[model samples]
Structure formats: structure tokens, C-alpha cells
Target: MALEIHNITFDCADSRGLATFWAGLLGWNVYYDDDPEVVVAPSYPNPGMGLLFIPVPEGKTAKNRVHLDVAPDEGTRDEAVERAVAAGATVTGDHRKDDGTGWVTLLDPEGNEFCIERGAAERGPRTSTAYRIG
Candidate 1:
């Protein structure tokens, strides 16, 4: 018997401004706001999986069947998509590639969508080779 994944809600109209834009883009902290809901996390007994932001009336029409693909543990990936467009986010899609691999589709700030790969020191080291199923 095992089942986890405490939070990951987000159905927002402004639950403390999308939990302060995802607690300043994952620096996570907002333990909990008010007015409906808003509870980011990365500490305080956080065993991983947290980010609530409720309060939904009706918005974000269509798109986003399930998203959130960030990858910058530090930098790169166009500087984390220019720090997520200077923390307001909105570059609907860019799918960077030309030998740099791809990923860069942001939206946040109430638009939803997410994605901005290329971390792990900007995807260096890992000659590649993986296909196992036994």
C-alpha cells in the first residue's frame, strides 16, 4: 500500500498571483497564502510534491492537458527562457534546436503551459545509449 503526490493543484485565477508565480519560479517558499488557496513548498517538512494555488472561476480556455517540464537546476536553456521572461512568462513556444536539442514553451502568469529544458550543465556529458526492457 503506497500512494503519494500531495500537491500539484493549480486551477488558478490568482491564488496569490499563481502562488507568486510558483514561488518565484521554484525557489519555493510560500507555505500557504489565503483567499481560496496557495501553498508552494521546497522545505518545511516537504517530502517533495507541493504547489497548490486553487481559486478557479473560469479562465485558461483550452490547451494544457498536463504540463510542467522545467529543467534548469541552475542555468542554460536560454538562461531558463530568460528567467521565464523576467518572471512573468509568455513565450508560448520556441522549441529550441539546431543541435542544441529542444524545449522552451512557457506561459505561466495565468496562461498555464510549461517547459524549458537543457540543464545538467547545459546537457553536456552523456554520450548516449539507453534501451533496456527486460
Candidate 2:
């Protein structure tokens, strides 16, 4: 038997609010907005993985050990970063190089870190050393 990923859960202060932020950024819809938990994902048929926001009493205190890296389906990374900022995300780090490589790190409304990478159009073609981590 093989196991599949259900959802990526997030512990937050306001589940609905955080879910809204993510939904807007990803162009996904909010499926569940009930108390205790809020879920956001691609409409219908389910996209295999969704974001689950659960309310918690405690607040985020440090950098997240695990973070999501997203790439735009259309437009440039700068455009995606702008959209994220307009939707309540804060830019934490700018790692874009002069040669049009790298990504931008951002913090969601609840301070959870996520990154925005070059879009498909911007990336063009994948190379052997495209994602080499130093």
C-alpha cells in the first residue's frame, strides 16, 4: 500500500484569515470556513494536496523549519511577489540574482515563512544545476 499526502497543515491564530490569505495568493478557493479548521485548495476534483489552517492559542516565535516554495503559473516572480504583498505578505529576503535567478522569501500574515520562485515562463528550461543548493 502506498501513502499519499492529504494536506499541509498550519497552526495559526486565525484559521479562516490565514486560509483566505493563502487562497488569494494561490488562486485556490476556500472549501471549509468552519471554526477550529479552515481549508483551501483548487476547486473540485481536489488537487491532491490542500492547505489546512488550524487555530492554536500560541503564536509563532521562530523561523519555520519547513516552508513552502511557490512558482507563478503566469507572469514574473516580481509580479507574484507584488501580489503576495498586496494580499498581506511581507518580504523577508530578496535572493534574486542579477542573472535572473533565485527566489524571494516572504512571511504570511501569521509570520509563517514561504518563498516565491521564478515563474514557468521565466525559468524557461530546467538545467542540471538549476536547483543546486549551496
Candidate 3:
């Protein structure tokens, strides 16, 4: 038997707006934002990892319980971070280790936490942020 992740869903305040933020952030396109309760990926045939944006209104009082640790598939780590920063995301801070093993934590449009870093294959140096799932 094997375990696989199907989708990462966010209970945000606005599905459409948040979807746009993430769509631009991850180079993902909208699946379907026409529905209120759900929005599938419209821009992709199968968004490798389905990113869902659902609606919630509690207002993210505390920090996120789960966070994404993302790697850049394009160019350098610095370039990847810049792209995210330009796409409606703000850098919370840098949390790299003295060994250069840390990640940049950024807040999405609705203030969700995610990270950007170099690919594990290259491993020139690595940076990681806190991440867990239940």
C-alpha cells in the first residue's frame, strides 16, 4: 500500500480572490471559481497537486496548522523567491540556518504561510521552514 496527497485545501475568506493569489503564486491557473462552495482548477488538466480554495470567515485568528514547503523548478532559489514576492505575497522573514539550510516564509494574500527554496536534487545548500500535517 502507498499513501499519496490528493489536494491541499485552504478555508479562506474569499475563494475567488484567494484562488487568484495562489494561481499567480504557484504558476497554477484557476480550475473553477464559478461555484461558491468549491472551485476546481480551471487552467490545468490536472494540477499536479490540486490546490483548492474554499470559503471560511473565522478570520485566521491564529497561525496556520499546516504549511507548504515548496521548491523552485525553474531557475535559482533567489529567482523563485522574487517571483512569489511579486505575486501578491509578502515575506514574513528569512529563517535560514547558519549552514544555509532554512527557508523564506511568506504570507499569501490572505496571510497563509508557505515556503520557497532550492530543489533537493541540487542540494547545493538547503533551507527548510516548519511544516507538518495530520
- Candidate ranking (TM-score, best to worst): 2, 3, 1
Q: How many pairs collide in each candidate, listed in order?
A: 0, 0, 7
Q: How accurate is candidate 2 locally (lDDT)?
A: 0.92
lDDT of 1 by residue, 1-134 (tens): 66898988888787887887778887878865345787888888744888787886898788989988978788788987898799899997797879999998988888889898898897888898999875
After superposition, candidate 3 runs with Cα above 4 Å error:
1-3, 37-48, 97-100, 120-134
- lDDT for each residue of candidate 2 in 1-134, tens digit (9 for 90 to 100): 66888999999998989999999999998876345798898875756789999898999998899999999998999999999999999999999999999999999999999999998899887766656555
Whole-model lDDT per candidate: 0.83, 0.92, 0.75
Candidate 3 weakest ten by summed lDDT: 37-46
Question: Which candidate, 2 or 3, would have the higher lDDT against the true structure?
Answer: 2
Better of 1 and 3 by lDDT: 1
Instruction: Give the CA lDDT, 0 to 100, for residue 72 in model 2.
Output: 95
Give each model a TM-score: 0.36, 0.91, 0.75
Worst ten in a row by lDDT for model 2: 125-134
Candidate 3 structure quality by residue, lDDT tens digits, 10-108 = 988988888877767666677663576544453456555677787876888888999988887667666778888887889998986777566789998
Candidate 2 wrongly placed segments (more than 4 Å) = 45-47, 129-134
